[model samples]
Target: MFIKGVKILFVVLLFYLMTSTSTTPLEAYEETSPARRLHKAHALCTLNKSPPATDDNDNEQIVETFIRCMATKMGLWTDKDGYNAKQVAKFFNKHNYENEVMTIVDYCNHQHQQTNLDLWAYESYRCATEGRIGAWLEEYYMLSLKL
Candidate 1:
């Protein structure tokens, strides 16, 4: 009975945490100190350096690589770039349509009080590889600003 009660309590707590709408992403991020964020980023960067499994799409690997690249470019961490930030930036600039990348970068910077560097970097890579970054950025900008 005690074990069952504990399991039930755990499930309830998990549900509450998942369903709680009171905390925004920005607020949740702000609740952690900058040092903590840096530590987490460092750990993630280190852990994600290995290649993913053969069957996986490696989306998370891509995100992690982009995060590390952003950290390097921002001087938040000193690590070698397997994924080059300058090369990504050049690609983005070369392929961007009608300054949409500039607009998105500027808007994200204003919203984040920083460049939203990681997200922009990820989006740039996604755009280059997958196309339709402009539409995705527009939707993301609208939703994020609305929040």
Candidate 2:
């Protein structure tokens, strides 16, 4: 009788261990789901301005929109006084890319000087994604275009 009781207890303990160690479907899905990954990527993508659409699954369109927006700001949004380096610095600081301010400014300045808006926009996207997020964006979201 005592041995049977011990066997039942052992089975219950095993069941408890198995259930406790295993993650539920929802928990497992949340970890590796595309939606979760996209959410993280989107945070960096639209860090400043609003993208074309919040729920838009078209990554290419979103990136193009962002690049165009940046180009416009760099080219057309300047004051009569001229380009605002402080504004650029503040923008990078906002996105936690403070160290990239000088690099981006230099890159965009070169493009702006060349008077090529198209090249400026593409280069801006490349320089912006040059940090830790670049690889992930390139591989998963295709945010980096071959230039």
Candidate 3:
């Protein structure tokens, strides 16, 4: 009887923790102190080492690679062309920001389709970073107040 009661209590506590909006201080710290966003850009672009190919497609490909790398780092992308729903949900859950942000990606693919590759790449990075930072800042501020 005691063992069963203990198991039930554990389940209840786990559910509460998973469903709670409040994040621990360590989680806030990890979210606020984001890793360098452009680490992949320099290694992939290597513009100083050699000029990129003259073809527009080649230049665009470089931009695509950079954008993809950034998205992957943010857990918004997968090895395949698009994002995996399960993985994205897991990311948002782990980060504890499902209630704060709306769209899965900050910018939609259709809106940038007509733009120049450079602009598209910049917008992608900008939007993702802004959304993440905004959420992190809010969570960090709230947690700090609690502390």
TM-score of each: 0.26, 0.31, 0.32
lDDT of 3: 0.42
- Residue-by-residue lDDT tens digits, candidate 2, 1-147: 344334333432332333334344324547544433333433443466443555433433444444444334434223222234445455335356655665555555554443444334444444444554343333432321221
Q: Candidate 1 — what's its lDDT?
A: 0.40
Provide the clashing-pair count of each candidate structure: 0, 0, 0
Top candidate, metric lDDT? 3
Candidate 2's error at 13, in angstroms? 48
Return the candidate ranking by lDDT, descending.
3, 2, 1
Candidate with better lDDT, 1 vs 3:
3
Cα error, residue 147 of model 2, in Å, equals: 35
Candidate 2 lDDT (Cα, 0 to 1): 0.41
Model 2 residue runs over 4 Å out of place are 1-66, 70-84, 94-100, 111-113, 132-147
Best by TM-score: 3
Task: Give lDDT tens digits, candidate 3, residues 1-147.
Answer: 344334333432332333243354333444423222223323333333335658655654544555455445555554533433344444446576654443544233334433354445434433443456445544644554564
Q: Report the C-alpha displacement of residue 96, candidate 3, in angstroms.
A: 13
Spell out the clash pairs found in candidate 2: none
Q: After aligning candidate 2 to the native by TM-score, how far in Å is the CA of 99 from where it should be? A: 6.5
What is residue 32's positional error in candidate 1, in angstroms? 36
